[model samples]
Target: MGASKVIHAIYTDDDVLMSAVKKIKAEKHHIEEVFTPFPVHGLDKAMGLAPTRLAITAFIYGTIGLIVSIVMMNFIMIEDWPQDIGGKPSFSFIENMPAFVPIMFELTIFFAAHLMVITFYLRSRIWPFKDAENPDPRTTDDHFLMEIPIYNNNQLELENLLKETGAVEINIVEKDEAH
Candidate 1:
């Protein structure tokens, strides 16, 4: 396959970028990615991305944490080492459940938070100490970058469309060619 050409359309305003994305999608053009300094409200919807499932994952992780906390506390405090919980010798896990509430709550939050971060990192292909993959460094500041891949050798048409959509600067960059 021939090396694809990537068009980087730089827009200063997110409103303009969002409109461009809608227009481009209407033309049935596939947008590769969009980079902005901060999150742009409704950009994901504009790009027609599916809703994120991370929240569901977080809830599942929290449930696991709650179960773990209950099991671990039962083993440690009630079964293995029966202790005087709340100045009462509560030998039952249910009876001692009140004292374990705080631990369970904290563990639920901890597991959900930590696991969610790891999930997001993995999903984004981000790892610790990794170089940034942004095509332009300016996108990290005040600029927004929209990357579109050219197919069918329709470069001029794409360029014209981008120019009409209020792109401040448009650059045609070649993807890394493999020999």
Candidate 2:
């Protein structure tokens, strides 16, 4: 494949970045990616990306954690070694469930939070010791970057549009096609 040309538009403020994104989308140009120092609200909607399913995964993880906690507590308190504590004999899981509520809640949150993070990392292809993908490092500090790939000899048009959309700095770079 031929090397593709990409335009990197830098913005100082998120508001300007947001407006630029909106204008770019209005012009029907496909945005490759957007990098920001912090999360920008409604950027995803403006980019026309689909809604994330992380909440559903978190709920599933929490349910699995709850089940594990219940089973562990039941085995330890009722089946493994039944002991009389607080003047009550540990026999039935239902009867002893109240004392296990705290553990259950904690385990549920732990699983949901940890597993969600792992899921996000895996889904985003982020790993320890991985190379950074942002073309400009300033996007991590105090700038926002919008990447738009040029196709069919539209570099001049895109550059003009980006300049009109309040891009502080615009750069055209040749990016090797990733296999």
Candidate 3:
């Protein structure tokens, strides 16, 4: 079987990378990824990525936390073990809600943070102790790397196009299908 190939276009500046991305999209080429040393503003829009729905997941998680705290506090302080919380004579959970505000707030933050992390890991197909898939280490430091799949015999033409887009280094590499 013929090995798959890819082109790595490295840029020294984010501006150059952004423009190159636009050009690549205009030509109807698929971009696998763009690695950057830091956050590049508006780069996601340039790449035509859909807006993330993580905020919606966080809201759901926060709501779950709120419900759990309410049920647990009501059961523990009222039903299971009635106590003189906040020096209040009435032991009803409804009347003692003021004392539980801090607990509710804390649990809401805690659940949202933990669930969001797990959701991110699941969505990204990442887990603890997984091997790194970065094609180049320089992309972690100062270089921005753009990856484009090579189909048929377009390596030279893509290389020329990358160079025109201010790419500092262009490399054609064989990619393994099975890792």
Top candidate (lDDT): 2
Q: Estimate each model's TM-score.
A: 0.94, 0.95, 0.92
How do the residues 46-76 of candidate 1 rate in per-residue lDDT, one tens digit apiece?
Answer: 9999999999999999999999999999999
* Model 3: CA > 4 A from native: 1-3
* Ranking 1 against 2 by lDDT, winner: 2
Please give me the total number of clashing residue pairs in predicted model 2. Answer: 0
Q: State the C-alpha lDDT per candidate.
A: 0.92, 0.93, 0.89
By summed lDDT, which 10 consecutive residues of candidate 2 come out lowest?
Answer: 1-10
| Model 2 TM-score, 2 decimals | 0.95
Question: Which wins on TM-score, candidate 1 or candidate 3?
Answer: 1
1-179: candidate 2 lDDT, tens digit per residue: 44388899999999989999999999999998999999999999999999999999999999999999999999989999999997999979999888999999999999999999999999999999988888999998999999898889999999999999899999998886872
On a 0 to 100 scale, what is the lDDT of residue 153 in model 2? 93
Question: Model 2 residue 83 lDDT?
Answer: 97
Candidate 1 residue-wise lDDT at 74: 90
Candidate 1 Cα lDDT to native: 0.92
